[model samples]
Target chain A: MMQETVITNANKAYALLKADADKILKLIQVQMDNLTMPQCPLYEEVLDTHMFGLSREIDFAVRMDLIEVEEGKALLDNLEKQLNLIHEKSQQR
Target chain B: MMQETVITNANKAYALLKADADKILKLIQVQMDNLTMPQCPLYEEVLDTHMFGLSREIDFAVRMDLIEVEEGKALLDNLEKQLNLIHEKSQQR
Candidate 1:
C-alpha cells in the first residue's frame, strides 16, 4: 500500500480545507473530552488556539506530501479529526 | 509583569523535572479528561506518547530559558499542570 495512497490524497485535500479545519478541530475535541474547560485566560486561550489550529492542519498535510515525517506522519494526520469528535460526542450519550 | 516571572521559573524548572513531567503529564490529562480513552493502535499509541511527552516538556523548558516563545509563551508553559489534573479530578467527585 503506497502509504495508503498518499493518505487517500490527503483525505481529499482535507476535504477542501476541512471547513476551516473544523473550527479549531471542534475546540480540540472539547478540550480533549471532559467536554469543557477553558477559564484562566481561557486556559491559555484554548491552548493557544489549539496550537494554532492543529499546527495549520499539520502544515498543509506536509506541504502536500500528505504525510510521513520521521514517523509522526504529520501529527497523526490531524489526529483523525480529534478522534472523530470524540466518538461523535460519545454516541450522543 | 516580566512574563509572570519567567513562568515562575518554569514552575520551578518543572519541579526538578516535575516527576518525569508528571508521567506524561498524567497521560496528557487522562487523554484530556474523559478519564481514559486508549484503543485502536492504542489511539495512535497515546497520541505518539503525548506528542513525545509534551515535546519533551517543551524542549526542557526551552533549553532552560524556562519559557517564552512568542505569545504562546512556550505552550502556555505546559498548560498549567493540565489544569490541575482537571481540578483534582473534579474535587474527587
Candidate 2:
C-alpha cells in the first residue's frame, strides 16, 4: 500500500512538472515570437533567467543525489551544444 | 588537423557552457539566499525561468538528435523528484 501510494504521488508530481515545463516553454515561445530582428535585452534576459533556473534545479538534484551526477553532466553537455549552435547562428546572421 | 580543430572547438564550447551554467547557478543562489521568510514570487520566478530554459534546451537537443530523448526524459524525471522534495520540505517547514 505504501509503495502504491508512493507511485501515485510520484506520478502526480511528474504530471505537474510536465505541465509546468510546458507552460514555461510556451512562455518562451511567446517571447521568441515577439522577438524583434535582434531580439532585445528582454528576450535574452528571459531566456537566460529560465536557463539559469533549470541549471540550478539540476545542480540541487545532483547535490541531493536525486539524479546521478553523470546524468546532470550529460544534460549540461547537451545544453552547451545547443547554446553554441544558437550563439553561432545568431552571430552568423 | 581537422579532427584536432573539432575537438578544440568542442572543448572550448564545453568550457564556456560550464562557466555559463555556473554563473547562472550563482545568480539563482543569490536570489535564493536573499529569500525573506516565504521566498516570494521573484524567487520562484527566477527558479522556474531557469528550469524552463533547461527543459526547452533539452527538447531542442532531442529534436536535433544531439542528445537522446531517453536521457532528456531521465533528466526530467530527476528534476521532478527534486521539485517534489523541495515542495514537501517547504510545506513542512
Candidate 3:
C-alpha cells in the first residue's frame, strides 16, 4: 500500500512535468515564429539559467529516489527529440 | 564572425548547464545522506515543478538555434547516468 501511494504521487508529478514542458516548447515556437535574428543575448542567458535549474531538479529527484532514473531520462529525451525536430524545421527555412 | 560568436555563446551556455547539473546532483546526494524515507511529498512536488521549467528552457534554446539537439541530449544523459549509479548504490543498501 505504501509503495503504491508513492508510485501514484510520482506518476502524477511526472504528468505535470510533461505538460509544463510541452507548454514551454510551444511558447518557444511562437517566439521563434514571430521574431528574427539576431536574437538578444539576454534571452539566451535567461534560457540557459532556466535549463540549469531544471537539470538540477531532475538530479535531485533521482538522488531522492522520488522518480526512477529511466523515467527521468524519458522526460528529458522527449524534450530533446521534440526540440531536435523543431531545430531541423528551422534549419530548412 | 557571426557564426563564430553564436557557437561561442552556445558552448559557454552548455558549460554552465553541465556545471549546474553537477551541483544539483551533489546537493541531492547530500540530502539523501541526511534523511530517511518516506520523503515529503511537497519536496517531490517542488522538484517536479522545477524540472518542468528547465525542460522548457532547454526546448526554447534548441528552437532558437542557441544549442544543438545532440548537446542537449548529452547534458540530460549525463544526469541520467549519474542518477542511475546513485540508484544502484541505494538499491544494494
Candidate 4:
C-alpha cells in the first residue's frame, strides 16, 4: 500500500510537470505567432519567467522525492529544445 | 494507513515550504546586512525572483493536494510581511 501511494504521487508529479512545460511551449508559440518579434525583450523576459517557475516546481518535486532529479532535468531540457526550435523558426522568417 | 500516509505527505510538504521561505528571508537579510543597498535594482530583482520561485512551489503543492490552498497562501503572506519589515528596517537605517 505504501509503495502504491508513492508511485501514485510520483506519477501525478510527472504529469503536472509535463503539463506545465507544455503550457510554456504553447505560450511561446502563441507569442511567436502573434507578435512576430522574437527579438523583443518582453519575449525573452516572459520565457525566462515561465522557465524559472517551472524549474522551481520541478526542484520542489525532486526535493519531496516525488520525482527523480534526472527526470526533472530532462523535462526542462526537452522543453528548452522545443522552445529553441520555435525561436529559431521565428527568427528565420 | 492511507490516511496516515496522506497526513505525513502534507506535513512534509508544509515543512519543506516553510524552510524554503526561511531561506529566502535569510538571503535577503544577508544582502541587507552586507550590501546595505536596499534601493538597488539588483536587490529588488533578487527578491522578486526568490518570491516568484517560492510562489511556484506553493502552487504546485496546492495542486498536488499535499497542502491546502489557504495554508500555502498563508505561508507566502507571512513571508511577505517579514520581508517587508526587513526592507523597512533597512530603509530607516
Candidate 5:
C-alpha cells in the first residue's frame, strides 16, 4: 500500500509536468500560427519565462523524489524539440 | 498508512519550500552585505528570477494537493515581507 501511494504520486507528478510542457508547446504554436516573429523580444521573453517556470517545477518534483531527474530532463528536451520544429516552420514562411 | 504517507509528503513539500525561501533570503542578504547596489539591474534580475522559480515550486506543490493554497500564499507573502525589509535597510545605508 505504501509503495502504491508513492507510485501514484510519481505518476501524478509526471502527468502534471507533461501537461505543462504541452501547454507551452501549444502557446508557442498559437504565437507562430498568428505570425508572431520568433525573433520578437516579447516572444522570446514569454518562452523564457514559461520554460523557467516549468524547469523549476520539474526540479522541485525531482528534489521531492516524486520524479526522476532523467524523466524531468527528457520532458524538457521533448518540449524543446517540438518548439524548435515550430520555430523552423515559422522561419521558412 | 496511506494517510500517513500523504501527510509525510505534504510535510516534506512544506519543508523544502521553506528551505528554498530561506536560501533566497540569505542570497539577498549576502548581496546587500557586500554593498551590491540593490538598484543595479543585474541584482534586480537575479532577485526576479529566484522569486519566479520559488513561486513556480510553490504553485506546483499547491496543484499537487501537497500543500494548501493559503499555505503557499502565506509562504510567498512572508518571503516578500522579509525581502522588503532587507531592501529598506539597504536603502537606509
Candidate 6:
C-alpha cells in the first residue's frame, strides 16, 4: 500500500483500539460495581486477560510498520495506568 | 449475595462476554478484509492475543463458580474453531 494509505489505516486502527479500550474499561467498572466480593479473582482475571490482548495488538501494529513502536508502547502504558486506577477504585469500595 | 443473585449476575456476565466476543470477531474480520498482505503478522498477533485474553476470562468465570468448568471449556473451544475458520477465510483471500 501507499505511504498515505498505511498512515490512514494506522490512524484508523489506533482510533478503534482506543475506543474499544474505553468500552472495556467501562464494562469492567460495571462488573466491579455489582461485585459483592472485594477480592473477586474472576474479575481480576478478565481484566488482566483483556489488557494482555491489547498489549499484543499494539505490538503487532508496531511490527507491521502501521504505527511507531513508541506510540504503541505509550498507548499500552496509558491503558495500564487506567486499569490500575480502576482496580484501586474497586479496592476502595 | 443470594444464590439467585449470583446466578443472575453470572448470566449477565456471560451474555456480555458473548456479545463482546462477537463484536471483536467482526472487528477482526474487518481488519482482515482490508489487509494487503496475506501473511500479516500484525493481524495474527492481535487475534491470537485476543483469543488468549478470552480464554483467561472464561477460566476465571469457571473458577469463580460463575459457570461450570465444562461450559467454560466448551465456549473457548467453539471460539477457537470459529477463529480458525476466520483465519482460513483470510488465507483464502
**lDDT values for all models:** 0.50, 0.52, 0.59, 0.94, 0.92, 0.66
lDDT of 4 by residue, A1-93 (tens): 789889999999999999999999999999999999898987887788789989999999998999999999999999999999998999888
**Residue B2, candidate 3: C-alpha displacement in angstroms:** 1.8
Each candidate's fnat, in order? 0.00, 0.29, 0.10, 0.61, 0.58, 0.23
| TM-score winner, 5 or 6 | 5
DockQ, per model, reads: 0.02, 0.13, 0.06, 0.71, 0.67, 0.10
In terms of lDDT, which candidate is stronger, 1 or 6? 6
* Cα lDDT tens digits for candidate 4, B1-93: 889878988999999999999999999999999999998987887888889989999999999999999999999999999999999999898
lDDT at A73 for candidate 6? Answer: 80
Cα lDDT tens digits, model 6, A1-93, are 355654665677577567657867887878867874547776766676678866655544454444688887878788778867877887776
Q: Could you give candidate 3's per-residue lDDT for residues A1-93 as a string of tens digits?
A: 655755764665566556656765675576557653315664454445545555555554554345688887887778768866765676578
* Chain A superposition TM-score per model: 0.31, 0.53, 0.75, 0.98, 0.97, 0.82
**TM-score for each prediction?**
0.23, 0.36, 0.45, 0.95, 0.91, 0.49
Give all candidate RMSDs, comma-separated.
17.4, 15.8, 20.1, 1.3, 1.6, 17.9
By TM-score, the candidates rank as 4, 5, 6, 3, 2, 1
> Which candidate, 2 or 4, has the higher lDDT?
4
- Over B1-93, each residue of candidate 5 has an lDDT whose tens digit, in order, gives 778878988999999999999999999999999965999987887788888988989999998999999999999999999999999998987
Give the per-residue Cα lDDT of candidate 3 at A42. 48
Model 5: lDDT of residue A89 = 87
Which candidate model has the greater TM-score, 2 or 3? 3
Model 5 residue B27 distance off true place after TM-score fit, in angstroms: 2.1
Distance from true position, residue A65, model 2, in Å? 29
Show the lowest summed lDDT stretch of 10 residues, model 1 chain A. A63-72
Candidate 6 CAPRI level? incorrect
Residue pairs of candidate 2 with colliding backbone atoms? A50-B49, A50-B50, A53-B50, A53-B51, A54-B50, A54-B51
Q: Which residue segments of model 2 deviate by more than 4 Å?
A: A1-93, B1-39
